[model samples]
Target chain A: MAFLARIYVTPRADVLDPQGNAVAHGLHSLGFGEVTEVRIGRYLEVRIGGSDRAAATEQVTAMCERLLANTVVEDFRFELDALASDR
Target chain B: MAFLARIYVTPRADVLDPQGNAVAHGLHSLGFGEVTEVRIGRYLEVRIGGSDRAAATEQVTAMCERLLANTVVEDFRFELDALASDR
Candidate 1:
């Protein structure tokens, strides 16, 4: 079976996110006073072929550690869905 | 009430994504042959204060159009959850 993994990589809470701060400032200037905070991150969609959900999760986790995410500065999470039948 | 909106902005399918292509190539060279394609996008978390969900949705949508997303080359979707009690 094939699986599609949707991963989100976000900077650690303690990290300084200048881009996010800039966007927040822009929003405030535009009169969106209700919008208090904005944080930006990376979204990734990865397609993989595997025999089962467990195997696919293992593969995707390895990919995250090796290439998909930088654990030192970012944290990652993902959701997997079977895609063979949808196509 | 307060709500948190999680937004994802992705390049339109017809548009060219050089960054995504570069990541795919990098993965291919790293021996992940099962990985077929990769699409990169932006993930954003917006914290908003409002009295109701419908009103909050309206505000968030307007924010997306005005600043949160670039409607020309990208498309966006969001999920909202009330956050008043979480704290």
Candidate 2:
């Protein structure tokens, strides 16, 4: 089965996000006063050939831990979908 | 009303994604053979105070153009939800 994994890697709450802060400031200056906060992160789309959902989940988790995300400063989450049906 | 907008900004398909290529190579070297490809992008969570969903969407679209994404090389999409129920 071919699965598409959509992953999100976000900065840990304790980590300082200078880029996000700067964006928030920019929005305020642009007259977007209604925007209260902006947090930036990474989004990844991966296509995996796997036996089943469970197998695909395990592989994607390993990928996230090993390379996709910096675990020390980022937290990762994902959603998996069968690609054929979606297509 | 408070709305939460989840946004994804991805490099245009024609754009060269060197970082994604490097990560894919690393995955192959690490023995993740079932993984065929990886594309990297940006994710953002924005909190917006608005009178209604339509108003919030318009504001967020402007935000994406002016500050959230570099439209020259990227494409963006978003999903919005009322924050109260989600919380």
Candidate 3:
């Protein structure tokens, strides 16, 4: 099976996203008034093959935890789009 | 006001995303067979104050170019979900 996964990796809410904040501040400096906050995150689209949707989901989830996302300060969520198993 | 902006910053099609490739290789190592490709990107949620939608779009576009995205290697698209003007 092939799937289109949209993975979002965000700084845990309790963890401040300084990179995001710095960008926001920079925006303020560039005259974008009242830019309050910016939350930065990562997105990934991966093509995977599995026996079934659940199996693919499991594989992708493990892939995320092991390599794609850092669980310490970042949180991740994925939306799975099951495509025909052509490839 | 508040907005939920989904910003996608992806490597230009011609540019290689080594970090993404590395992660995919790691997935293969971990037994997610036939995983073809992985493209990584950045997403952002921001809060901004603008006179109107057009103004907000312009401000956010500028923000993406000046600070949020690396135009040389990356291409970005943003979806703006406008909220009520209470804030």
Candidate 4:
């Protein structure tokens, strides 16, 4: 089976996110006073071929732990769906 | 009222994403041979104070148009929700 995974990697809430802070400042300067805070993260789409959903999920999780996210300061999660073209 | 927006900015399908390619290579090296393709994008959380849902939605749209995305090469979308602690 083939699957597509949508993965999100976000900084742990307690971590200081300098990039988010910078974007918040930029939004403020642009007159978005209503904008109070900003948090930035990475979104990834991974396509994988595996024997089944469980195996695909395992592969995606490993991908996150090993390559996509720095687990020390970030948390990662993903959703896997069977691809329409899997046939 | 306070609202939280989850925004996604992704490269257009036609654009070449070098970063995505680099990650695919890394995944292949890590022995995830079943990994076929990868695309990377940005995920953002924007906290806003607005008068109403309509206004908040407008603000989020403007933010994407003006700063959050390069519309010519990227596409952006968002989900807005009423914050529970708006009081």
DockQ for every model comes to 0.80, 0.77, 0.72, 0.90
In candidate 3, which residue pairs get closer than 3 Å at backbone N, Cα or C atoms, i.e. clash? Answer: none
The total of clashing pairs for model 2 equals 0
Per-residue lDDT of candidate 2, residues B1-87 (tens digit): 699999999989888888888888899999899887788999998898875999999999999999888999999999998987343
Q: What is the alpha-carbon interface RMSD for each candidate?
A: 1.1, 1.1, 1.4, 0.6
Candidates' C-alpha lDDT: 0.87, 0.89, 0.82, 0.91
Ranking by DockQ: 4, 1, 2, 3
Interface RMSD of 3: 1.4
Evaluated at residue B19, the lDDT of candidate 3 is 88
lDDT of 1 at A22: 94
Least lDDT summed over 10 consecutive residues: which range in candidate 3 chain B? Answer: B48-57
Off by over 4 Å in 2: A85-87, B85-87
Tell me which of candidates 1 and 2 scores higher on DockQ: 1
The docking category that best describes candidate 2 is medium
After the best TM-score superposition of candidate 4, give how far the Cα of residue A35 lies from its true spot, in angstroms: 0.7
Q: Model 3 Cα displacement at B9 (Å)?
A: 0.5
Kindly report the root-mean-square deviation of model 4 from the true structure over all alpha carbons.
1.4
Q: Give the per-residue lDDT of model 4 (tens digit) for B1-87.
A: 689999999999999989999999999999999888898999999999865998899999999999999999999999998887643
Give chain A TM for each model in order: 0.89, 0.89, 0.89, 0.94
Q: lDDT: which is higher, 1 or 4?
A: 4
Residue pairs with backbone overlap in model 2: none
What tens-digit string does per-residue lDDT give for candidate 1 at A1-87?
688889999988888888888988998899888887888999998888766899889878888899988898888999999996544
